[model samples]
Target: MIVVGIIGRPDSPWCHDATACLVVDGRVVVALEQERLSRRRFAPGEGPEETLRLLLAEQGLRPSDVDAIGYAWADATPEIARRVDSALPCGVLGTDRLTETVFPTLAAELRNKEIFFFDHHLCHAAQTYWFNPHRDADVLVADGTGGAGSTSLFRVRDGRFELLDRYSPLWSIGIFYEAAAFYAGLGWDAAGKLMGLSSYGRPSGRRFMTFDDGAGEFRLDPALRGLPSGGFTEERLAHEWTAIFEASAFPYAAGASNTFDYATFATDVQETVEDVGMALARRLRRRSGHDALLVAGGVALNAHLNRRLALESGYRRVSSTTAPHDGGAAIGAGLLAASVLGEPVRRRDPADPLPIFLGPAVGTAAIEAALDAESVPRQALEPEKLRAQVAEALDRGEIVAWFDGPIEVGPRALGARSLLSSPRSRTTLDRLNVIKGRAAWRPAALALTGAGFDAIDIEPAVAGLTEYMLCVHRVGERDWDRVATGVHVDGTTRAQHVADGSEFGALLGAVGRVSGLPGLINTSLNLRGRPMVLTPAHAVELFAEAPEVDLLVMPPYLVRRP
Candidate 1:
């Protein structure tokens, strides 16, 4: 059976989205996010039409070949925009036109495929449990808002999912963090900025939100209680967030003030969120009597908090998939819909539940064509010679744009699509930030072979998620200086472990043989705020634009700007 799952609704105020998964006979054949195809970061307010079209064309399939289509939202009602002439990506269709005309056209375009809608939170839960290695585990789904609620806890056993509890959107941890991000003088989408900034300062003694795990309750200041439940205009959310922070006794730095005070606030918010997350994990573990835990939702992307849960929280195993965010929701929606229809669900290997190569693979021919089209200088080398050249480039502190195989599905760049530099170089971090147009404070991840773990101190809990770069783990104090370029201010590193015998492992091995350190600083292969380079053309474009990139490696081919 061919099952295609899509995330995001045509009528809903969500557009920088839409991810699709094509499953055949219980196995995922392809998974692609709309943002990659649209060349828009997050591609808000856009449906997966372009993405689906591209995937189908690439796979030699047609819409008529699909058995069932699953949408991520259930009963997602469209809302009237409070303001006219809005250019918000989520409101691209003009909220008024969505329900009346847009969605109908979208539904009709699917032709004869049967459509199924799954609850938003159910999809989040499914994203974790369905493909998770643990057959029976406690699952936590926390996000801005799902169809049922913002936060959901579930227990899974023998392929059966039981909801243990849910928290209303009014008490959503995700929204609170978003508010914190807004108050930090950043866009709501830049919550990860606040997380990164949190590492630079010590915690302030004040708390902006409170959580009572024993009672299963959480609250923002009572003064902000009047904010709409499950929905809020950006203007309203921003205004209320400013007012709440200003009115509270909490210590907030001047909006235009020094970095120390801003970082202090960031630290406070980060520490508080982690505290609540840990408490929730403890409660879930006790209630479900399960040793393993699977975390899903946008909040799961907070590497800092995920690290805390992995190391400090008392769970035997804590793991999350590559697409823990909404992009992964499409895969979950398909799996859940398949199960509801009595189809066998393909369980991902626990050790490697989601393959690193889920996205489209660009072949050497494609790379050659792109290089030729661009009229760029290049050379073709044997496999060993190519690895040596790339590794030697890194050893000389040159930034190498590495496009090995299929693109990575999630936000983080695994080995497949990465910009690599010597992690030991002190100035490499700053140069990388400049290359990607990222904030100087944002930290890069370290990609290494499995043996790379020997040089670092990784807690057992965090060890589980090393493959996907889901959790942050503290670098050994002794090794901190060795991998300083990849270590955050807090002495933590978001690391991706390359499995032995993989092509990436061999590359890291080459680097290790030369440098004695089996790792390099790896960031997503794209410009700052840009979607990852999805095609050879995209990679060539980025290589041409990023002057700091010294070499562009497309396997047997290499391109260097004169």
Candidate 2:
């Protein structure tokens, strides 16, 4: 069945914030994000133009040839916004002209095919639990907000998602940290930056939180003295967070700097995050009563907390898809539709789940075209040989864009769409930060081969399979001093685990053979505020505009600015 799934956000932080994914003939295709088309990260202001094109081309069929178009949207989206806007509380939603207008661009494609809508939270959970490599796993969905839900619990057995329950995001761990991060002066929506900074902190635990059992909720308590859970009121939190830290020894923005005091302050924040995470763990267990736990959502982005939850909860295994955020909804919505259509779900394990490199990939001609357009030096080497050459460059302390196969799903830079550099190069780290217009202190991920595990104290690749580089794991004492560029201040690294059979496995093996270290630090292929590039033309535009790039190794082609 030729099925297409698209998920969008109306008030997304970024524009053209739409992602289109397709499942065609047992192949998971169309990894294109709307941001690629508009050159905007999370493009919400635009429609899915390139997305529509890629889907059409992948099937060699026009829009009319598609079987169905599935959509995932926040429940009560327009009404929620209005209700939240006018201080009105609601249960069942009423008419919403604003949202129906947003009815999504899929309506444009659905004229000839069946149009279906998947619940927002359901879509998120489906992405991680239903479509993830682990079926029948305990499921948890957490994100900034899912319109109707901030978090949800579910059970999947025999190709079905049994709804367990949901909780409002107010006790919203995502919003709590987001507010703390913002108040900490770490740019807005840049909680990852704070996470990287957390290792430097000492976890003083002065800022204790309380769980309101009577109300079945949590709050920063003293800081949250006057507020009621009206559902993630950042305004209320802005004042509360400011008061708490100011009341504490740390100044309001003291956590922003990389100092002993700031690190200590980060410890407080980490403690707060952990406490909240643990509390959620307790609540989740009570709600589901299932041994397995599946967690997806922005809050799940807190690796330390996820580790804590895993250790504390009765659940033996905690599985989360790489993109727990709304981004994965495209994949989830696809699964929902596919399953309904009687498509077989794959549980072959993470090493080979759906071949998630479902986005756009450039052919030799596309790469060569980019090289010629940029007037950069060019050549074609066999991919295996090119891998060796690239590994050699990384060993020699070079930074190159490994613009390989199909783009990755979600936010992790899974090999295909990565900027490669020597893990040990401090200079490269600093330069890379400046290059990406982000923070150097924010660590890059070390993409390592399976064999490399013994050389260093790599975390159990199974405990953390961030082959997409989403979760953060501590760097082993043996490897920390070596992979300096990849290690956060806390001596932790976000490692994207790759296996030998995978396409990225070749690059890892090649790097291991040449560097003897078995890993290369990798970050996203795009610069700050930009989406990962999708086409050779997209790459050319970025290479011309990108300031930190030194070379682009798009297989069978090379591009280096003059």
Candidate 3:
């Protein structure tokens, strides 16, 4: 069966992170986010039409070839539809337009193919659990509001999912963190930034949020839920959060000149999240009696919390998919559709890592065409020679834009489309943040081979989490000077473990030969506030725009700025 999964509603303010994926015979063929093609961050107020069409065309399959379609939202219910309508701004269509107009129009366009609507949190759970290697494990899904609630727990035994516990949106930990982000002068989407900033301050003794393990309750103020009011405006939430924080003796940091004042607040929020997450995982473990845990949803993206869960949650094993956020819901939707259609879900081998480079791969002809179109000075070198030259350039403190193979599907850059530089100096980190239009305090990730782990203090049980840079590890005191640039303010580094046989691994080996270090700082290759480069032309365009990037490497052809 060929199933197509989509996540988004056309022109819906509450809907974002539009994405689409294709699954053929229970295997993921391609997954793409609309933001990447639309060149808009999160692709707010957009639909998945373009992304769905691209996936069909890329696979050489026509509309008739698709067996069914899956939507990430359960729009058929009156409650969800009413919620969506209330969140829309003035002059927008009501919920009737969705079931009476939009979905029907979609079905007609696709030759009357059956469309399946799934619960939002179920999509997250299905997506993460289906792709994971664990067959019987406890699953946790936590995000902003979903159809039923914000947080959900499930137990999977031999491909069957049993709902264990769920929490209402009012008790959402995701919204609590989002409110903390807003109070710290960062936007709602700046949860990653808040996580990074938390490292700079020590946690206060007070806890803003707590969880009861026995009662399975997530405690927080309901006024700080930050849900959409009558319209798609944040003013109401802003006022409510401001009043609540002020009442608690924690004034808003709207105009604070020193960010340090909010640092403690950020740290407290981070700790609260960790504490609650651990509580949830432990409770789930006891309820389900499972040794392995699979985590999904937006909150699963927190590396520190993930690291702590892996170490202290008592789940012998913890794993998460590369795209655990809403963008990944598309993949989950596809998998769920395939399961409903009587297709057996393919189980991943326990020994191998999950395949993340699932996007389209650019060919040599396309790379050469892009280079010729730019008319830049270039040199064609053999694979070995290219690696050596790129290593030497990086050792000389120069940045290289590495574009090869398929693009990564998740938020991380990985090695497919990344800007790489030697992690030998703090100056390199500062320069990279400037080029990427990020704050100077943000830290970069280190990409290295299996041997690189010997230089750091990492637990063997949690090593799998480092493969996709999903968790952070403490930098050994002795090797602190070696990877100072990649280490964050808290002395932890988010490391990406590269396979020994991949092209990126060979390049790291060459760098190790040249500089005695097997790792380099790796970050996404994109213009500021834009999605990562998708095509060879996009890579070339970024090379032309970012003057600080010294070399552009697209295997077999290396281009240098004139």
**Cα lDDT of all candidates, in order?**
0.75, 0.66, 0.78
RMSD of 3: 5.0
Best of the two (1, 3) by lDDT: 3
Candidate 3's TM-score: 0.91
Candidate 3 off by > 4 Å: 76-109, 221-239, 249-251, 351-353, 457-463
* Residue-wise C-alpha lDDT for candidate 3, range 192-274, written one tens digit per residue: 88899889987766666678888998666454434334432233444455455645624454535665678888898899889
lDDT of 1 by residue, 193-216 (tens): 888888888776566667777787
User: Candidate 3: lDDT of 442?
Assistant: 77
For model 2, the superposed segments whose C-alpha errors exceed 4 Å read 9-16, 25-27, 74-109, 112-114, 207-216, 223-225, 228-249, 253-262, 286-291, 310-312, 340-354, 546-548, 560-562
Candidate 2 at 191: error in angstroms? 1.0
State residue 554's C-alpha deviation in candidate 1, in Å. Answer: 0.8
Collision count of model 2:
17
Question: Which candidate wins on TM-score?
Answer: 3
lDDT-wise, the better of 2 and 3 is: 3
The better candidate by TM-score, 1 or 2, is: 1
